[model samples]
Target: MNERVTPEPQRRRRRPTKQGIVLSQQLIIDTALRLVGQQGAGALTVRRLGISLGADPSAVYRYFRSTDDLLLAIADELIGRAQQGWQPTGDWRADLRAIGLRIHANYQAHPQAAMLAAHRTTGRTHEIAAVEAILGILRTAGFPGPEAVRIYHAFVDQSLGFAALDAAALALPAAARTADLQVWQASYARLDAATHPHITATAHLLATDMRRSGYPYALDLLLDAAEARLRAAG
Candidate 1:
């Protein structure tokens, strides 16, 4: 009689979300990025994230302590995306140039996220990796430790500063952005030459130039200075 006893059935694990999508830190970050990109940073509340994710808000909290934590993660994720597939070519100036441009371009690609998170200090993986790579380039280029740090500080600040500035413009409502872009042409270009001779003289140039991002030219200037410093150090 004992040999005929039945065995118990095994229970299946519960799925993390109603949509049956598996939860992960990367998936959370990706969803958050998309939300911010589409609806602006103000729309990135935990409840909204949960709705977008088809999960309980508690699930998101399990991965991040708070919204700020998630924002830092998003910022770090942008840094990671910027550096993805990048490798040093051993030409320090060229490498730094490439890294700076890559970071700027990536941030511009997600203007809302850039405007929201560009100024944050994540102390996360991508941020740490970026610092390491930049410092390595400067140090290998013959910069002393302190000089290398100083240069890295300036380099990162310049890149992020321009990113935030450009992103602010990009994040504006389409009509507003168009209005701002036309300021140089519509306002400055019409100024009377008598009282605004200098502005009038260069208004045409400003109309075109101001519409373009100054990041590339500024980045080259920084590289040129770094190259000069390296030469002078020798």
Candidate 2:
């Protein structure tokens, strides 16, 4: 008779980090957002995240293959936040306006993260959901398939482009931001009428309007055009 063969033991799972905190994908993303907000996007390295989470730097690799993967996840998270609690109002124009405003506000809320992520294509869950929702709205509005796609493309790019611009301004140093905001009043308002007739004429209005975001007006113009297109299609 032969002796019974012994079975090999399975490998043990990795335990919690030194701080006794369990790591999850959501947690990592939240921590990264916080770090970026507190410092800047450059502060979101593996080592920095490890320190923040009190885990091994390599632990982040277990969840994300690389920092770029993590950044994509962060970008997707922003989309997810923007879509949170949002329900389509059945009026296509109203729904589109709400969606665009939500995206812009969320990005503005997280300026540093927005600066890094506004232009990224995550192709992840949240981003895909947003695309599906917008496309559905356009198609439901009686837009043809190709037309719906074109409108969706323009709407998304316009929202992201303005968000990035606004975020960049928000991310500047406090003093610099103040100076930039004051330029219209201090410099443009003082321009000689002869040398800059148009600017000088509009200086007061420019001082007021330039301080506010042009996104809302631009968004309305786009929607107005789409409305006209629908009417013309009829």
Candidate 1, position 121, lDDT: 96
lDDT of 1 at 24: 76
Q: All predictions: root-mean-square deviation over Cα?
A: 8.4, 7.0
- Pick the lDDT winner: 2
Worst 10 residues of 1 by lDDT: 1-10
lDDT of 2 at 78: 100
Extract clashing residue pairs from model 1: none
Model 1: per-residue Cα lDDT over 1-234, one tens digit each: 012212223212247578888877888899999999999988789788889889876667556767888899999999999999999999998999999999999999999999989999999999999999999999988899999999999999999999999998899999999999888888999999999999999999999999889999999999899889888988
Compared with the true structure, model 2 gives a TM-score of: 0.93
Q: Candidate 1: list runs displaced more than 4 Å.
A: 1-16
**Ten-residue region with minimum lDDT total, candidate 2:** 1-10
Clashes of 1: 0
* Local distance difference test values of all predictions, in order: 0.89, 0.90
Give every collision pair in model 2.
Answer: none
